[model samples]
Target chain A: MANNHAGLPSPTLGDLVLPKLYSLFGIANKDSLYGAVAEFEDGPQLVAAGAKVKEAGYTKLDALSPFPVHGIDDAIGVPRSILGFIVICIAFCGTFAAFLLMWYTGAYSGPQIPGCELVGLCSYPLVIGGKPLFHWVFGLPIMFELSILFAAFASVIGMFALNGLPRMHHPTFNYSGIHRATDDRFMLVVEASDPKFKAEETLELLRSLGAVHAELVEDK
Target chain B: MAGHHHDHAVDSYQLDPGKWSTGRNVLAFIALLSWALLGFGYFNDHERFFQSYLVAFCMGTFIILGATFFVYVQYLTGSAWSVPIRRILENIMVSIPIGALLFIPIAFAGVDDLYKWAKPEAISDALIQAKKAFLNVGGFRLRAGILFALWSIWAFAIWTSSTKQDKTKSIEQMKTSSRWAAPGLLVVCLTGCLAAFEWIMSLDPHWYSTIFGLYCMAGGCVAMWATVTLISLGFRSNGVLANTITVEHYHDLGKWMFALSVFWTYLAASQYLLIWYASIPEETIYYKERMHGSWAWVSVLLPIGRFVVPFALLVGRSAKRNLKVLRIAAIWILFMEFVDMYWMIMPNFHEYAHGFHLHWLDLAALGGVFSVYGLVFWSRFKSNSLVVEGDMRFEQGLHFHQV
Candidate 1:
């Protein structure tokens, strides 16, 4: 089984009889396909390899490494997204929330004052530096805090969303030799279904590009 | 720090011990003495720019002192990467005492010249009167003394340990700095903040902003980065650092320069927006002086020049990789930061219709500060290894390019 899988490029569409295989294997024509696994040593190397493979005209390829690699996105031709824009958006939300919450407390959520009948919401005058909601001096602190909280929280979410986590399945997991990715290993996987892929061609390409080894994986 | 390397230097990774001159003690004394006399003449000749001269001199001094405080902080944190560069900051901070000696006027002579509220007759205003306990000379000098003592100790720690390490090559000295780093930093920040309020911000007497300390801190950090940028460029241009300081190292430094510029702007804006939005007379008066007057051009240029100009120009590729371009951006940022400090400190006198304006003496005083700053730093470089070779992070910085 080990020798059978050794050094095979990610499969090309032409190498398989899709209709018969779909019937035999009971998969939909619109099914996802997993590819052969290649391993790497460190972040920069993985990022470099991912870039080269992408430049070789393959898409739908995925990379796994022991840690996140900088430029991995551009190396694999992914477009950049806005971490700052989202932070601004969240900040906007936070600022509004802080102001509104403060206003609500000042105008309606009246604190207990002895001999003051629970003043109706409308009866209470909103006063911060006598500016009302038109200008709330006291609320400026709240506004600043809100903006900071939102920006920080959004930054965390943005980072996590970009990384994509907690999934129980990945195609690379099927590559038994590739398990070292959890340790001091890095890997790039190209799908068999990519239009530019060919089993022998990709194997040759990866090996030529200085992969230590390459082997096919069956979809889980 | 990068320029200290030479290719014959490859064979000589060790510092050239000959550079530290015992013979030039007389010459060094002459240089410092001549500049001190020259600085006094320059200030005495231009009495009209008296307030400007004092504020500018004090600010320049505070910047060096504040930066020293920051370095002590990073040292106490056991920060490996910064150790290579901390000595330059220490050298600059040593100028603070020199500056403090220079600031004797604010201690006693400038009571009538600089402050309107300092007069006993002007104490009818209750708020100003209330702050009198703190605003008085005895109190002011007392606090000033305390601030100097705290900073001197922090600088003394690095200065003494570093020179000791130079002689003995003890790793434990590094560990000693690391252990006290955390607490020393806390004191530096605390004392540094009070110094800003008592020394600079409270010059207005009535106006107060809680964010003012942070405002000084952010500016201080940016100023320090600019000083480093200027030093790095000077070395590289002289062709002293052959393979030692490469484009990759510069790219890293430029990234930091870029990051600090933006952070300073963020802090400055945060403080400004808070004060502006509140619309309180006491708080808003701080901006009123600079925002509208002969200083108006500076007020306008500050936001546009300091932040927007650097942000747009540096947010590109060639600026960071090319040393000259990065230096230009750094120079511009430094220029804008100085302008911003001018905006903060100078406007109060003129804004109240006391009839003050910017003048050329400001430049001479600034020169005095820089001349002394440079002289100290150069002397320090002569004694210590220009780069910290024994630091554990030396290898990290070397491979900082490789990966």
Candidate 2:
């Protein structure tokens, strides 16, 4: 029988301990100060804090949780997503592209074939099975497929572009405990750049709204 | 209240039959009078009467079938959002038996006049001779009878089981209903397709499209959704189910109606496009007949009225959420549904004519068929609980909202 710990490292007290050096990354400077972070145990408390901060006229605030909290977007006064409109416009382009492709290849002339004497491309009005040169019905399937293809592409690209995702670093990551945002905890970050943000006042407000811990986090 | 096994307040949502007695009586009277007028017209001019009767019969049967489809879908999807208004659907479905009864007149007298393939002399043609096995009067009647029987049985089974669950509150009953719905839906689809074939498609026996069944089903679902929206609005206005079936539910129903309109358009457009592209003489004849006459205007208007206008009006989220907008859209859709049925059936009658013909019999037949169907629906609706109050999911449905 194989041992359970065959390929594993043994647990040690050193692995469980927090770093003791307070200034290991050097003293925080003006450029590296990110914002204040507030942690809440659940969604409602985070939403409550976000609403209060929004009401106090803080514009640069975001709420994060392991899952989406219904009504929180409106509570935080986030603008409606415009990704749908972008996808629709791109989908129309897709339809147009499909139409043009079908027309040039089948109905209209394209680049000349090497052995053919036709000036522009494949012979125009080359009838197949007595079908018309450019029947819309013949083009509809391509048009439909391309439209869906373009829309899906636009949806993914537009979502990432609008969200400013794939960012290697964010201000929220300055807080050591912020990794909990992807787990059990809810977090709200009030950016230092927001005009209404007052470090002391914002921290106090978060605490009053049931934040388990509030602290000013410095960016690296 | 939390520990209470049952809530008595739920009973308040049940319909008060006495409340709408006067209205019911009036509808009943109008129905009787319309039937009398139709009978007289049928005897006076049998040919014209049959033409118009086919249109009305198609509309009524499709409406009932649409309701049956909705009920099965709700069970199949395990949707709680429709629980509050499910009873209204059941009531609408109960009209199927009445629809079958209405078909008796057409079965006995109108078949020969309405169906071109019903004539033995016409079968001498190669196309008719080839199709004689399926298009013959005997086969048509048998298929129609089977379709109606299947529809009635499934509709009754679903409705009875649902109402029974309201009293028992048995999760097992819910399971059983879901079990029945799987097979029930298959039967509905099959019979619905055959019904469309026997009732409408065979009117122009030479023309055929495999997509016709889906096109009819889409139209039926749209019509049913519109009717449901209108009735729900009426109930809200009259202070019945006002709390249980809220604006949220209406919004959901409006979305369904909007989606079905698009579906109906897709199917109709696909069928037309395929036939036009092929340009085969057999298939092209259908559009040729429809396009050359004043029916051409109707042919153009079908897409605009049925698809374009409704799509534009209902595309906005606020339009679906607003009661007044939803009501207008619903009424518009219902009118378009009538136009759709009219377009399908009326062209066969005026194939040789250059212009549209408006006959008094058309109105009489519409009024006759709808009034009787409405009477049956109203009676069934009045006798049932306006809301399924005992449904375990009813409270959840009442609070359902779009996030």
Model 2 residue B14 distance off true place after TM-score fit, in angstroms: 2.0
Q: What DockQ do you compute for every candidate structure?
A: 0.07, 0.20
What are the runs in model 1 whose C-alpha is more than 4 Å off? A1-35, A39-62, A68-168, A183-198, A201-213, A218-220, B1-49, B117-132, B166-170, B241-280, B313-325, B350-356, B401-403
lDDT of 1 by residue, B191-269 (tens): 7778778767876888888878877777777767777767656655544443455666667567766777777777777
Error of 2 at B339 (Å): 1.5
lDDT of 2 at B232: 86
TM-score of chain B of 1: 0.85
Q: Proportion of native contacts in model 2?
A: 0.38
How is the predicted docking of candidate 1 categorized under the CAPRI scheme? incorrect
Candidate 2 C-alpha lDDT tens digits along A3-99: 3567667655554432212233333333565788999998877777788889989888888899987667876888878887899899999999999
Cα shift from native, residue A106, model 2 (Å): 3.2
The residue-by-residue lDDT of candidate 2 on B126-173, one tens digit each, is 888888888777777777788878888877777787778778877876
Would you list the clashing residue pairs of candidate 2? none
Candidate 1, residues A1-220, lDDT tens digits: the string is: 2324567676566546665455445444443446767776566766777778988889877878777665677677765566766887898899999887676656654564554555633325555565655445456668878989988999998877875543445556667776688788878888898899887888788777667778877664
After superposition, the stretches of candidate 2 with alpha carbons farther than 4 Å from their true spots are A1-33, A52-59, A109-125, B1-12, B350-353
